[model samples]
Target: MKVLYLGDLVGRSGREAAIKRLPELRERLKADFVVVNGENAAGGFGITPAICDDLFAAGTDVIVTGNHVWDNRDILPHFQRENRLLRPANFPEGAPGRGIGVYDVPGGRRIAVAQVMGRIFMDAMDCPFRAVDKALAAYPLGRTVQFTLVDVHAEATSEKMAMGHHLDGRATMVVGTHTHAPTADHQIFSGGTAYMSDIGMCGDYDSVIGMQKAEPIRRFIHKTPGARFAPADGEATVCGVFVESDDKTGLATRIDPVRVGPRLAETMPEVV
Candidate 1:
C-alpha cells in the first residue's frame, strides 16, 4: 500500500496550495491512500465542514486534527457524523469525533488511521501511547487491516519520536504533525515502520510557524497582546512524507519526503 501523509494546512494559502497540488501528487506518487492534517485550516485556528469537503474533493482520503480541531465550533456537530475527519482518540471517551477511522483504499484494501495529541507542551489529554496502542491492538496489522497509520499531533519532538518508536513495527507509518515545521529525520525504524519527526506545514514558511510575522514578532518583543495571529499569505509550500508499505506484512518498504510549491525548494519523491 502506498500512502502519503501531509503536514498541517494553515489557512487560505495552505488550503489552496493543497487543493491545487494534491491530485497531481497522488498521481505522481501513485499513492493509494492520502491523509492530510487539516487542524489549522480555518484562518489558522480550526477546520470547518466546508473546508473538509473541499479537502476531500481534492483527493484526501482521511483528515486528522489536533488541539485546534474544535476552534470553529460548527465542526463539533459536523465531526460527529464525518467518518473521514478525526480528532485525537484519547479525548475523554465521549468526544464529538472519533480518533480512528477505517477506510477502503484501492484494490479493496482497508486501512486504519489514528490520531493522538501529546500532552507535553500541549493541552492535557489521555496518554497518546496508550490510546494508539489500544487502537492498533483492535485493528491488528496484517490481520484486521491491510495498513495502519498514526498521526501524532504534538508540540514536543521527543514525545512524537517516542510515539514513533512505540508504534514501530505495528503501524505502516508514524508521522508527526502540529509543529508546523518539517524535520529532516525521515527514516524507517528497525521495526519497519516509516517515521518522520514532522512533515511540516503546507503554509508559508516565511512567518512564525505559519502565522503572519508582525504580530508574533510584536508579542515576543513587546511582551504585550497586540492582535490575533494571521496566516501568512505568501507563496505556500506543500510538505509531507510518502511511504510505501508491503502488502503481506503491512510494514513500510520505502519512506521519503514530498515537498513542492514556491516557499521551499521543490522536490517530489522518487516514487518509482
Candidate 2:
C-alpha cells in the first residue's frame, strides 16, 4: 500500500497550498491513502469543520490533530460526528472524538489511523504508550488488518522516538507531528516501521513555524504578547513523509520525505 502522510497544515496559505497541490501530488505519487495533520489548518491553531471538509474535498482521507485540536470551539461538535477527524486519544475520558479510526482505502483495503499526544512538554494527558498499545491491541496487524498509521503528536523528539520504537513492527508507519519543523531522520526501522521525528508544518518556510515571525520574536526578545497570532503571508510549502508498505504484513518497505512548493527544495525518493 502506498500512503502519503503530510505534516500539519497551518493557516490560510498552508491550506490553500495543500488544496492546490494535493491533487497533482496524489496523481504523481499514486498514493492510495492520504493522511494530513489538520491541527493547525485553521489560521494556525485548531481546525474547523469547513477546513476539514475542504481538506476532504482536496483528497485527504484521514485528518489527525494534537493540542490545538480544540482551539476553534466550533469544531467540538464536528469532532463528535466526524469519523475521519481524530483528536489525541489520550486526551481524557469523554473527550469529543476518538483517537483511532478504521477506514477504507482505494483498493478496498482497511487502514487504521491512531493519534496519541505525548505528555512531555505538552498538556497533561493519559499515557501515550498505554493509549497506543490499547488502540493497536484492538487491531493487530497481519491477522485482521493490513495497514496502520500512528500520528504521534508531540513536542519532545525523544518521546516521539520512543513511541516509534515502542510501536516498531506493529504499525506500517509511525510519524511525528507538532513542533512545526520537519526533521531529516526519515528511515525504515529494522522492525519494518517507517518513522520520522516530525513531518513539519505545511506552511510558509519564511515564518516562525507557520506563524508570522514578528510575534514569536517579540515574545522571545521582549517576553510579552503585543498582538494576536497570524499565519505568515509568504510562499507556502507542503512537507511530510511518504511510505510504501507490504500488503501482507503491512510493514513499511520504503520511506521518504516530501517537500514541495516555494522556499523548500523539492525531492523524491530514489528507491534502492
Structural similarity to truth (TM-score) of each candidate? 0.98, 0.97
Where model 2 places Cα greater than 4 Å from the true spot, the runs are 270-272
Q: How much is 148 displaced in model 2, in angstroms?
A: 0.7
Which lDDT values do the candidates have, in the order given? 0.91, 0.89
- Per-residue error for 44 in candidate 1, Å, reads 0.7
For candidate 1, the per-residue lDDT at 272 reads: 72
TM-score of 1: 0.98
lDDT of 2 by residue, 90-187 (tens): 98899898999998776667899999999998889999999999988978887667899999998899999999999999999998999889898999
Error of 2 at 28 (Å): 0.8
Count of backbone clashes, every candidate in sequence: 0, 0
Alpha carbon lDDT at 146, candidate 2: 84
Error of 1 at 139 (Å): 0.7
